[model samples]
Target: MRFVLAIVAFVVAVVLVGLGIAQRTVFHESAKNNLTVELDQANPFVVVGPDALTAHPGTQTVSVSGSADVYVAYGRTADMNAWLGDVPRTLVSYNKDKDRLTTAGTAGVYATRSPSPAPQRKDGSATDAPSTAAPTASVAPAATSAPGTSVANVPSPVGSDLWLNELTGQQLVTTTLSLTSGISLLISGNGGSVMPSKLTLSWPVDSRTPLAGPFILGGIIMFVAGLVLLLVGFLHFRRSRGPRRGRPRGLRGLLHVPPRPAKDVTSTGEARSGRRRRVAVSVSALLLLSGCSPDYWPSPASTEPAIETPDATAPVADPAASAAPKPGDLQVEPAVTVPQMERIMQRVSEFAATVDSSRDAKAAEQRFTGPALANRVANYTIRGTLTSQPAPPPIPASPLTLTLPQQVTDWPRAVLTIAKDSAAPTVAPMALVLVQDSPRTNYRIEYTMSLAPDAQVPEVAPASIGAAPISPEFKGLVLPTGQVGAAYADILTSGDASKWYNSFHTGGDQLVQQLGVEGQNTVRSGLPKTASIEFTTRVTANPILALATNNAGALVALALQQEETVTPNDGGTTGFQTGAVAAALSGFTGKSSKGVQRVTSIQLLFYVPSVSTTSAKVRLLGWSESLIGASELK
Candidate 1:
């Protein structure tokens, strides 16, 4: 019974220790975030978060686990996204800065990004967003103190990241990320076509917990319990030995001396020898079982499937799964990188500089087409005539945004919304349009117009994930992008009598009140009865841009030109010739020629619905007007 009791206690101790250790093994692995990246030789990476990236509270080392086959690189994610995605493959040429390149085979790819802006309150004050650092949380801001200073600011981390790509079919990847200020993961795809899909990040619940305390404590407790039982068993054997010290214990007392029957002498000496031998064998077995080894039970071997035990010499190639949210009208991935955007923006800026210059008008000419072309030419003509000094290149304001990809088909289109700083004190920022026809073609500046003071830029997804482009003919709002111009034109030509008139703002009415037949009334009432004036306005071209907003609406910018022509009777009555008349009649003088052709170019920005279910009415946010040409004779 004593031996049996000792075995039970030892077994219990072994189990407790094994359970505690098993729990510890379960949590050794940390968390991760994964996503697919389409490959492009020109731009080959999808930048992840530069959000919170501190190591687990108790973890000694935070290492990103990945493979060499897919390749990797790293860099510090900076607050400035200046040349973000445009880093050349061999960056040494473009950048000779101290920031070293993070290449594969040495340091793996990892990065950090600037934190998001805090939300603002109704009173125009800023407020904090929710926290994003607890386990399983999405990316969010984290506070950090500069080295040697105690002030905490949300600055960009210093470190680069890596890209993973494949040659044949898509490659399934599992990359372990390192612990630092934060990181952004970059990945490329096969042939710039077959890209990664989605990512699943798995890790222990509490990544900070190191070797769990319960397991170690259980092990210690069991060791002590085991030793106590072993000593007790041995002591009992010592204390119980006085009586049957010389006699065999006989295999746990199973073998006993029966009262020697009276006929013991009758038994052969050979039989007695055999009995004695069997007894000796049993006693020897018991002693052997109870020696140096504890006989109660053996400590349980680990039943855990496997553990990610830290090993410096051979880093484990942790496998990451692949898949992503299916692309739809809205995608969380960008169509271009920061570098690509910078290039696009540069071209537009250069083109804008060319606007006030005659040296390279063709470059700007190629970019401006349709109404935009007319607007640019008219601006040049007007500015040449109106300004006393050489016009400066239009400078863009801070906080420019690139509308993410909106078109879903192979022919995806996006809009680059630039807020041009205009000299006109009341003028709102100018919005520019950029369009790319295909993957290989470069994005071209298609149009530019002013946003109204009261208008807010439509909310769109981040540059990483693009917004869906609304079609010109989309009927989701009160009107379609294509129809707004015609409708507004009809309203302008006929005034409130038009049915679609109320669906729009009172800008048309205001323009009418300002330039209506009453202006002609001046010529009608002021001029002789035989001579009269007529005013005609026409929509010169299609809407230049139709950018999608998050509310299933669009911000459409269009061009409208209104021409006022005057005529004289056979009596030949003379009328006032404004400088407009002088400019139009510069080299010609005739009494009966069309009195004067006055041209006023109008650029209008309107908010129209791009989706079908919204009941929101169309509103005109802002507009810009210019007398492009006022000729003497029509």
Candidate 2:
């Protein structure tokens, strides 16, 4: 019976071990789920919707091929569609029930138009020349193109500031992301007429077998038990078969018989050695199995049932969901997302660096506009003559401290951002105002001002929930946005005597202290006795940008032109100092019969508190000054 039990145990152990090993090797499922789609219809741009990316519950790996240069970008779905505009594109979505990706073609006509001309300076010189080539439309080709039809020309989406992230590769591109709803991917072929022809998406899947380890461990235990049982059975048999001394025939017989057998020393020694070997083998097997990972073993399932109280009956409402506009309601998206703004700032920083190094006014104009462009172009011109002139403060790319985008869904969008340079800690942070005139055009920096050390930025809507653009005539503030520049100009001219002087806070205002009436009087005191000086300050023609803050006030940005003229009082003429900025800009080598005039462009950013606020004042946040123009008095 013992032998039979031992044999059965050994058989059971072998079967269990074999089954466990087989489960892990032959019965394991694929570690990842992969799906490949081949395009039957060619399109200029292919958009992969969020549904396809989030179909599985893990990070998605997307791969594209069949193009010389593959380009991929992901951003907000609304932004992608807005960029597409009237242009058509192929939309790819996932059908969970069908377990496959489906593509639909949007039908639309492709049209090209000339880009708007760049703004001109006061001297009628074009700040930047517009591209003569017609802008290529990024539209989708017909679902089934007619025979002999050439591919449609498609503009590449590379380097667009709208994208939160972008990737590109030669012939193939692969990226992994864990996407959420309302986010999408755009794929193209690096400005080629045709997009990539193939796409592969993969997601990881769990393939571990919980029972493998338990079964193997159990088998090892049973094998050890079987070996012990077999050893015991064998010993019993040996004892039974051995010549035994008959206790009855007695004591004398026992001693004589045992001695005659010679004790079978070799068999006894062999048995003892075999027992030790079996014990060692069992211990080795246990140690080997013990080192395996817990993932191989079966996990204990919870025995407690889920219990719900009255409080748990209702699901918690998501704040974002609650705040979202209801169906059929107008939903206005921000001009740009936070990540998109960051990318734009980085590009702007790079462009600024390039322009600064080369002193290229034309190149600077491409990324700058209005007062910002004027200042940069003037600086470049001054540097051309006066190489020692300091360049404008650098626009850092990283550590975007604040972002305020306009809440609108139309052309001519604006966003304000404050960025600091980690590499240059001593340099003050810069506040930039960027504008996008149309879907086809990239954002350009309109105003760049270095923030004051003690400047305080008011609370505003989050980047996700952008603030509304206030009109010039908005009365919610202590003063109208349109009049802010003129008011500040008055304060600069009349000092405490100006009626509007008290409306602003001049403490810590560097511009005010440097260009105010007191400062101008000081300049007059230094001039030649025969020379007379006059100062005139007025708002420029540049449009003012005002974005609403959370406190019902508005953050305003405007430009003022300050003219300083020095004329000889007694029919004599005066000239600028030898190395003055005015001399360099005017190109006047020596004293001129006519007086010299210098025009300084000042860009100011202010925060005006609402009328309801107590003891409110217009606070200066940032400012920039540049000698934009200088000439001999006409």
Candidate 3:
């Protein structure tokens, strides 16, 4: 019995040890190694550099004047191309003697630049560049010795490079990427009060280590031991019910009392009873051994996995009903069907025929949302002019009638057909197609109408064209890393900067204060209009940090002159107001408010660095506006 129990205990311990090893993956292996990165929080750009170079677009080359042995880190060419200003530019024109960097895609070399002194080569050969034009001028950095500036590149594990943005004030250890190379590159650098003497490149390290004394592992062992012992006790009881096989037949016969006559039945009964007692004693011994055995137990179960229920929140079709078809799918399983569409057109045509001139304009207003409806109110004019209204307008439809491809199952779609009034010079037909993705549904409706001279049609949402919908890109403005600064640019050009400044309104003052207070430190000494703002020195709010601190994130910034305008120029007012400037500024709170009032166009740039690898970033940008004038009228 003791031997059997011991064997069971050994098997249980082995199974549990295997389980513990599998659970080790949950810890982060890089916990011992610190990594820092600097990010342009305002835009999706991170400059990982100092010694590394990345693949360039169209053989685009970057010359470094500040650091020796500068490395460039390059991402995939296709992704880099998507960057607004990172498009491959022809550096030199083989044909035109005028061969500096230009938009034309042609081959060329730097007119005055030196090739890399220690460039890494793919073929394992070192080579010097043929003499070109004079080497590009080098900027002498401040003479202060930089301590521990050695940088190195640790090739990220394939498919493991993470995209990171800056958080708040923590030092960044970043890998700088430059596109000087023809292909992708990566350069790693350190951060803090000082840089590192040598960079240690690490692959994804194993996160788990043996716990102190392996307490958890030990506890697990004991639990398994107890469970095995319990199970063995039960098994031993079953075996004990059978007879002991080792007792020989001859010994049993010798020990057994001879069968007695009827007069000796009592003695025979007593002998049988004694044998039964011995059997009971043997069973008890087995139970005791099994109960104390350590090998029969198994580890206890861990936390239960979460169970999922049907998500009532989602829009689901009833199991008992037919599913709704999507527009992209072909409902008429055969070829394309124009008859159904034609029937809809007929109904529209009939409706148009009955429209009376007096009632048509009113009816159109009912269906229009904003400017479209406004056009009908005044014959499409801002003033109350009804003159020059178009006769019958042309019908609207897609340039091509599309058929659903076989690959689609249930595509969502909607169609609206509009007819023209024959009495009013045969108004054109109009068609509107709608695609449903709920709040992001795509709508396309086109119609030509005699509109006000100033009226311009708004573009359809990006989702309508089967693309991701991003907010409108700000015009005539560029972000720190060259992205179209959208929302922040609008705030800079909000037309009421002076008014907001004069009254110290929270929104307007926020911009002004950020520019004068926060922005002042970020600037190196150049006036706002003269120096190109160095993006490296600026910082903004760290959204996650704000949540951790103030419980909210707010935008603050530097403003651009080009974005702020008093009146609309070639660019429309875009929601910004235009008004005359009031010269009499009675009260001013901040020193920045005392400046002379003027109108101009500008944009805002904002960003912040990180605290931990996991912290949020702060950001800032410029604001621009124009002074009101007589020429600016609603």
Candidate 4:
């Protein structure tokens, strides 16, 4: 009976082990799920929507082929659609039911009208309409046509500042991305003339088998037990067959030492050996079981009913409570995302560094405009002659302290950012006002000012929910944005006598201390008796940009031109001091027979509180001055 049971256990062990091995081999599933799509009609560009990239709940592996050079980029869905305006493209999506990829031809709309006002729900949250309404037939030109006439000639998506991240390769490209909702990918070929014809997306799958380990481990245990049982049974059979000793047993019982039954040494040795075998089997079973983890075996169903415990910190539902506001409600998307702005800042910093090292004023124009560009060019020129003169402060890229972007959906947009240099602790932080004129152009620094050491920045909307652009004539503030520059200039010139002096906060104003009535008197007192000086300031034609703050105030930026003229008191000739910056800019060699004039360009940034606020005042946050022009009076 023991032998029969041992054989049965052996048979069951063999079956279990074989089944476990098979489950790990032939029965295993693939590690990844792959879906490929081949376009029937090639367009100049392809857009992979966010839904398709996030079809599976893991990282997506994207591959593209059938083009000499393949380029892939991912950005906010809205930005991708905006860049594709009026351009023909193909849309790629996943069909979950069919477990395959689908493609449709689409064309973006190019609206000529201004962007509509942001829509608001009853709860005061904001929402935006979809940019692309529906799918349209492919409008890619059949053959090569005039460049401007064909929609196929759209600008290459390669180097566009809109992309958050991008990948490129020759002939074929593959990349892995872990993206979230509202982010999308765009694919195109070099020169925007050809599009990749094939695209593949793959995601990893879980392939662990729970029962394999348990089955193998159980089989090992049974095999060892069967061996022990077989050994014991064989030993018992040997003892039973030992010497047919009925008579010997009787004699040994009378005189147990008659022959000692040959001492039954073999029986004792066999018994000890059987015990050793059982011990070995037990040890082997323990080792095999110890190697396994919980995942190796199936989880057992609980027999006891689970108790429900109330969490002490969990909030109780209130019948009168208002529902939480939805994301993106009352919030318009900024002109650029935070990551996008960082990249732009990096690029601008690199270019500025090159320009600074080379003193390339012409090259600076590419990244600067208006007063910023004029100031940089003037500095470069001054440094060319005055080699000992220090260059303008460098623009740092990293560690952006504040970023306020304009909420708009049109060609022109603006952003305000404050950047600080970690390497130069003595240098003050710089406030930059950047503007983008159109989609094709990069953002330019329109105004750059050094913030006051003790300046306190007002609260503003977050980067995700950008602030609205305020008009120069906006009346919500105590002072109109358009008149801020002129008002401040009056305070600087007339001091307490100026009509607008009380409207500004002058307690901690460095510009007023250095360029106000007191400073002007000091300069006049030092002038030679033969020369008379006059000071005049006027607002320039540069556009004023103002953005709303959270306190119903506005942050305003404007430029002013201040001129200083010096002439002989009694027809005596007067000239600038030796080696002066004004002399370099004006190309004056000696005393001027007429008179010498110096024009200083001032960029001012002010925060004006709303009229509704008590004791409202306009505070100067930052300012920059450059001797942009100087010449001999005609």
lDDT of each: 0.45, 0.75, 0.27, 0.75
lDDT of the structure predicted as candidate 4:
0.75
Tens-place lDDT per residue, model 4, 497-540, is: 99999999999788888778877888889999999888887777
Give the least accurate 10-residue stretch of model 2, judged by summed lDDT: 308-317
Comparing 2 and 3 on TM-score, the stronger one? 2
Write candidate 1's Cα lDDT for 350-432 as tens digits. Answer: 55665557633355554454445554565555445445433433646333544343323222244556554544455457766
Instruction: List model 2 lDDT by residue over 313-415, tens digit each.
Output: 1111222121333466445657777767777888888889999889887777668888899888888888888989999888899899998887654556788
Candidate 3 lDDT by residue in tens digits, 1-634:
6446555665654554444444343432433222222221211122323122211111222222111222323443212222212211222112224322111232212122111112112121222322222111111111111112221111111111111111212232333222222223222221212211222222223233443124334434544555557667778878779876678778976796867688679888988799778856755564454334222334443332322111111122211111244555322221012332333334333333333244365444222212222223333221122233342333332222321111111212222222233445432222222121111111111111222222212221111111111111211112211122323333333433422222112343455444443443443243344222222111111100000011111112222332111222333322211211222111111222113222222223233221332333233322223211112122
Give candidate 1 misplaced runs (Cα > 4 Å): 1-339, 354-360, 382-397, 401-405, 408-416, 420-427, 437-442, 471-475, 507-531, 571-592, 610-615, 628-634
Please state the error at residue 422 of candidate 3 in Å: 48
**Any runs in candidate 4 off by more than 4 Å, and if so which?**
1-23, 39-42, 106-108, 116-154, 192-195, 210-243, 246-331, 471-480, 610-616
Candidate 3, lDDT over the whole model: 0.27
Shift in Å, residue 515, candidate 1 = 5.3
Error of 3 at 57 (Å): 24
Relative to the unseen true structure, what is the Cα RMSD of model 4? 9.0
Which of 3 and 4 is ahead in TM-score?
A: 4
Steric clashes per prediction? 43, 0, 99, 4
* Candidate 4 TM-score over all chains jointly: 0.78
